[model samples]
Target: MSKIESIDAKAVKTYARTEQTVSDVRSYRLARVIEQLKISNCPAILLYDPVNIRYATDTSNMQIWTVRNPSRYVMVFADGTVISWELHSCEHVWDGVDLDLELRSAVSWIFFSAGHEVESRCATWGAEIVNVMRDRVPGESRLAVDRLDPMGTSYLASKGITLLDGQAMMEMARLIKSPEEIVLMNESLRAAEKGIERMRREMRSGITEQELWANLHYENIKHGGEWIETRLLASGDRTNPWMHECSSRVLQKGDLLAFDTDMIGPNGYCSDISRTWTVDETKPTDEQRRLYSTAFEQVHFNMDLLRPGMSFSEYSEKSWKIPDLYLKNRYSCIAHGIGMVDEYPSISHQVDWTTAGYDGVFRSGMTLCVESYIGAEGGTQGVKLEQQVVLTDDGCVPLTSTEFEMDWL
Candidate 1:
């Protein structure tokens, strides 16, 4: 039996909380933002992306809601000063206290006024931005912006302020994690493992795929998780082509269930883990065993090839080659960097380097997720496995601890 299956549900929960501890996560994350500003040669950054704002300012109010409406934003100067703007009434969510940064309510007049609302709001918001820039940034200083609406863009154009790609800069900064960040990531991984344990206990024939997926969501939220990234959970024939999300399909006596937990846990760090299991009272069929073992071998082989100072090109060239039959339906990337969820520096297959790959040297402190999927285009089912690891001075260390389903192997 796998280590996860061997443990009882209560033991799994205890293990998840064993190493939980507090750290100065805010300071560490701010330091990273400062480092990014220096590297990118920007005087300040205007962050519209909620994730980047959360990283720079260490504050969040209705994060998921902000993704669509974007009712919040943050401005961080290279001098370490931060200003956050949120919806006026939503300030109560933070209990009337900002966490380690200046907080202000956004201009909500557009909501109350109807005539020329967009133009008026944009102009007013532009004036506020100009005022902040005058105070925090010098004359003719270049500003980086992650994203902006059309109105905001037009206003900035009128102001003649240059905008750089602040999203790329933030991704570069997040590529390597700090000690405190690692602590939060470890905590997140533990929470994810607990969720996986719950799924293992609940997996069986006659359960709907959505029901199984709900088990993970319930466990994660109960353990202080923020949100799950995707719904890529499938069983039976849905597992063959891959990328199939959870549905109402009921699992049968002998079916392969595959899922990827793109979980954003405590402190906003992401834990990207994938596991495949068999929903059977007896052992898996020979075809099922072969597929599972191939995927397992692929994951470990690529993980073993990881080391500090390896070039992305070199790794891509030397990585495992999926069989011809399985290559057609292979996942987009063999491995990808993960911090806030698939950050940067994706290592694609060697054949795909010229088209879809990036060039960089893997450095110590970089965290990555090795991915594997083995299935034929017309096959009945497939197996997928992924593991999270961080590069150390000598070798890579695992971040996720959930074991592979042994019964399938």
Candidate 2:
């Protein structure tokens, strides 16, 4: 076995910014959306989803907050014109930033102050969208919306505008990443690696799992990361049965600490990497070695099986089989597409695919996260391993370069 090479955060960050213009990446993404709209025969898109808004406008302010608040949104026309709406005075969030889109304050005073005329607010927004469509799309135009409140949907239907599933269109557009998007993802991965390095250095027995988790957050934010997607960190017995979020549980000497960094870093790309580390300076037990080694092998084995032009169904059928004993606690999917985070086209194990999977072909430029978790139903501990990679013309290239903990093996 060869030594795994790790990424140099500073170098990657420097190269990402210098090698590509952020505006160009934004344009590339928007162009993809436009292409998808044409294919779907939709003339325009009403993007209320913050992720889709960021994808179209290349700007975000209070993304997580806006997820439920409905304070901001964007509209993209088939001709590639973008109209961005922000809450009153919130438009200043992008004060000095350079962007290529029209900006406006969303009409939401009624909904915000009175809190009763939700339909009125939706009507006003729908009217504004109709006006854009009439001016930009000409005759018999249809509008696509990724998601909308019921009132908004009703308002659009009353206005006689056809609504298509904009979410599906956006997903199709985002399936294959552009070169610049890949660059931004690499930057995100490096930033995540920096966070992992901090966590590893601060790992020690007696420290609370939450305390160790903070180290990763500190490093990520210090380097301009946006937000962590989840708090799935656990130690010792908490590692089994999975999905255990970070708690105040103190680490023991021989405990295994497993974490999944479901984070959105620079440029809003996700860097999802999982690792299980031993807390003490002492060696892992024989059983610990077996679990970790099995997980590590499973992750790499599936990663190796990835290639361009493979049908999802075919891949699912041919992928490695989990031993029957470990199948009960196995992860939902052998791998999943990663872009903004767990995007699309999940490749489940053969035994699990019929009920849990979807079919699509793997194309060059698609980014994927290969996942593995090894633990028995009543096991005391488990190992979680994942690798992020980009599908190339002939094979896949790893985006995450952090070395697995060789000591555990």
Candidate 3:
């Protein structure tokens, strides 16, 4: 049986590196979206960010964009199927992936920013895209968008574009794993593990936090890592601050060094992990040991609580207070779902559930990172643990093999 139940891990590994074609991926993905929407006719999607662009068009070409200025807006349809135009005149038009010329020419409008083609140029491109989508898609045709700024939403409303919250639809689409996506995510997990191990080995006395970050990044890159989302390395006082911002402080004896990083794999999927270490030459202090154990317990506790059909807030409240009750340490909530960013859905609190924007039930095929940290001494050196897990029918499966333990070198 494969480690991942739904798909064959080995077979996925074989096709993982065929050099994905953006057009093919986009075409397939758009088909999937169309099927999900149950729309018989074709509908156009306007993409702006690289992430959304990658999701929609399957092309990572940065040039496919349009701007709105001087009361006239342009839309880059990329395909008549959506009825928009392709924006021309991007900074790196040459860098576009080799796509069909006909497909490129099908782009409709190329509205320029205020002054680019003419003086002082400023453009709210997303608003223009929404407006165009509203104008083109018939009132009966359901239009979907990933996210829209308030201004963009208002413009869509004015243009009569029926806004079907894109996040909800896209979240459903992204939550379930495709064969290709799973393999890429697995590759990202492997790279993160390698980076973690390298950091463990290099965590020694006298090492600067910046140096540790550099070492980890180098290792991740050396092992086919594609791009780093964040390079955070903090020590001592910084660690206790929960979301401790990374600094240039040097590690020393008794310093608890905490590092958190997330990166995109070769396939453009995301991998996020965090760990903390103490630089003591000998045994750690009593306080340090206590804090570490508290964090470890919570990390495992949250993992055990994860499953299908459970409410994120219900489970979160149940487990979030563990630190305060058991360890007598008060801190922010630990653990959250992980995907393309530092924090995401599939894991959230009751407040999040009721507070709007992020309340949802835990389901199979979602990925999350169970995280916990314990601070000491008015907010200084703290112990932390973070592990990535995927929701399964039975329970959850961890992506990385190594346990959350500090390497006191």
RMSD of 3: 5.8
Q: Which stretches of candidate 1 lie over 4 Å from their true place?
A: 1-23, 92-100, 108-116, 406-409
Evaluate model 3: give its TM-score: 0.74
Per-model lDDT: 0.80, 0.82, 0.57
The prediction achieving the highest TM-score against the true structure is 2
TM-score of each: 0.90, 0.93, 0.74
- Which runs of model 2 end up more than 4 angstroms from their true locations? 1-16, 93-100, 109-114
- If ranked by TM-score, best first, what sequence of candidates would result? 2, 1, 3
Q: How close is candidate 1 to the true structure, as a TM-score?
A: 0.90
lDDT of 1 by residue, 1-409 (tens): 3232233323323443222223355666777888889888888898988888777765677778778766678888888887878776766544533345677877633443425586887788888988888777758457899988777877887787888889888888777776556767877888899888888899999889999898888878888889998999999999989999999999987888899999998768898999988886457889989998889888888888988889999999999989998998898898999987788888898878899988889987788999999999889899989989877765566776688867655
Q: Enumerate clash totals for all models, in the order shown.
A: 0, 0, 15
Weakest ten-residue segment in model 1 by summed lDDT: 12-21
Query: Per-residue lDDT for 9-86 in model 2, tens only?
Result: 233334446434677776778889999988988888889888888887777878898887777878887788778788
